[model samples]
Target: MPRQACKKGSHACDGVVRRNAEPIAYAHGFDWRPAYNCKQWFAEHSEQMTSDRGGMMKRYARPLRLLAITALSVFLGETLVMLLLPFLEPLPQHVKVLLDASLVTALVLPMLYYFLFRPMALYIGERDRTQKSLSKLSSAVEQTADAVVITGMDGVIEYVNPAFESYTGYTQVEALGQTPRILKSGKHNSQFYEALWKTILAGGVFRGELINKKKNGELFHAEHTITPLKDDSGSITHFVSVWKDITERRRAEEALQTFSQRVMDAQEAERRHIARELHDEMGQALTALSISLQTAEETAESPAAAEQLHQCLGFVERLLQQVRSLSLDLRPSMLDDLGLASALRWYVDSQGQRAGFIPQMELDSLKTRLPPELETAFFRIAQEAVTNVVRHAHARQVRVQLHRREQEMEMVISDDGCGFDAQGLQTRNARETSAGLLGMRERVLLLGGQIAIDSAPGRGTEIRVRVPVE
Candidate 1:
């Protein structure tokens, strides 16, 4: 090290050094030295002399110092070996020995630095860049609202971001190395997952709705897109899933659907009420007027006129009956006052009277009281089914059965009529004959019930309906 003193009473010139080179004004004082001017001198050539005074110094300084030390050692070792050989070994092959030593030093020193130290430095730099990029990507994924997950080909979770943790109430530490089945809600069976995996393994994308359960056992809905990540050879190596929680949206859509159905149902109910009123009140008055007119005409003396009046009265009476029948078909009052079984019996009996097909009824062990809406639904379904049988079946004998089990109510209606193909009817477009069947199915579905129809060309038609009591 070299030192110099400043001029007296000058703070800028205090404790500075000057050497045999040109003087340059620095922050503290002026210095003149060849090392300050040379490009390969201390400040220019050495990393430590020009390094920033921060946390970065601790990381960079040690490696640079090691490199410098290794270079110096190689230089000194070669020089010392050459000097010692000339002083001690006066060999016959001195000239060849010196030539061989020079060649060895030149090759070995550079090979050592290139293979060992240079590779290590490059690897460290690459690793640092990779770590920084990964950190940035992780941060972005954590901040997103969508649930992103990376899973191995075996369907086990390898990584989950903070958003996943917040959404599922599971920390990465708790969920890592676990299978995605941890989020299963048990709503879907094994076949669902089997098909999903089959599609993905075939290099196809899968999109679906999944009902998942959280760590706290709360159920949520998600719309998920699963993509198979393939390697260069086109084999699936992993799966990347991105999903959004759509539970609230789904609930809103369901609510809208329910509202629409209710509106339709209300309109139907009002039409039925109007039809019933017309049949019961206006139809009866019309019949009474026709009967009184016929009585007055019968009391008159003109026989031809009386005959015409009688004909008019007869036509009017038939018209009244037809109107009443139409009104009753539109809406049945019996369904409201009576239970399902009684309403069904009344409908069957009325059909027998009109269509000339007596329906046998077997209603045993129906002691449980059903909900009013459910009762009405079941009665309407049976009525529609029976009407279809009367209109199309042309059978003489029909059987209606209403039975109760431990947790369910069942109604079965069978007719020995000209039954059509049940499977064909199911697949065909609805016509006048199938309209009644569609109505019955709608009623059953509104009550959350199941209906099954059995029929063949020559075989009788049988409809079985089951509604859960609870």
Candidate 2:
């Protein structure tokens, strides 16, 4: 056969691999490949399979040999009887018959044990073992927490475990003859079911979340999986489905997300309030104080008094600058008066000056202002990304790019700094520990947007965000 391209997911590649791999002797034509330790397991078990085959052959030959030996013993016994017939001529016919009968019984007892009784005993022992194994498996299936349903290839329910009855609120009698559609909540369209069947019938497992109704017409969430069961001839005979109840977990997650969003909203409101207070109240007071001190310095009689007043004026001016900076950091008024583009330019420039890094910006001039909430969200996400870069990324430069389209907007922030493992931070625990990342993700999720962080150790980090404007 010609060599095929070794591209993953191609049928030609799979065929070539299967042909190149060592043959596995499977009794039921199953070709399962474990995700882990496949080669080591196959190598270790190949020798064991050979040894078992040899032992089976020996067991089969032993019974045949025993039968042959029994036949030979019977022949010898008959020959001995014939030879002793002359000697037993004087004996009574009844006594001779008795002796012949006793001799035949003695020879046949051992032969029957070796040829028939022994094999029957072994078969009975094996049958008991098999029954025990099946009993254990049945017990496990009945006691499991997840619902398990077995359906024939025609999609009729054949069996359902006790958990299935509990989850669906149906008795075994009620569920046995009915199809799985009996529990349908009508939340999923026919296309969903068609796709599920298409996957399993084609020998692929389908795993997803489902909304199913109970006997009382209560809808619930479930994590479901369907797998095809094949026969010895490699034909699909049935499908086994498992459903794990996830209603409580899903509700809890929704509740948490809602709570987080509310908290962020409150936080923004507080920040806006504080920024206004600092700018309108404290800023005006400080500026008036500086003006008064400057006038006092110019009108002072003594040189010493004038010098002291000058120093006080300088101190007041510095305090005013600090106040303005604080107010801007809390929430910039420019974001409200101006637009996202101008505000971003000001923030980036100010951050570059404060952090001593080169800031490069490519912002689109969105002539039309976006929704207030959307603009806030975009600015906050950008602020967070840049703040993270300044704090953790000891880089000399940072780049921010913004693009606006007819239907959507995109923003990308990249830093040429020492990066951390973005992949490892994908776990729930990791996200929980990093409040910055979690907040960013939650913000995007609330806006029905997507955020992607690409980073690797010793390279750089890039944060990309996209949100629909429609």
> What TM-score does each of the candidates earn?
0.52, 0.73
> Candidate 1: lDDT of 323?
84
lDDT of 1 by residue, 1-470 (tens): 35333345644532333444234432210011121233323333364334445447887876787677666766676676677666656566877577657756775667567756787899899999999999988888878889999887666788887878988999999988887878888898766876787777679998999999999999999998889897644656788888889999989976865775586478668867788778878887887889797787979689888888888888888888888777766666666666667767777898899899887998864565577667767777777788787778899999999888777789899998988888877777767446677767766665667999999998888999998886
For every candidate structure, what is the RMSD over all alpha carbons to the true structure, in angstroms? Answer: 23.6, 10.5
State the C-alpha lDDT per candidate. Answer: 0.75, 0.82
Top-scoring candidate (lDDT): 2
* Error in Å for residue 420 of model 2: 1.6
Q: After best superposition, candidate 1 residue 337: deviation in angstroms? A: 1.8
lDDT of 2: 0.82
Error of 1 at 229 (Å): 17
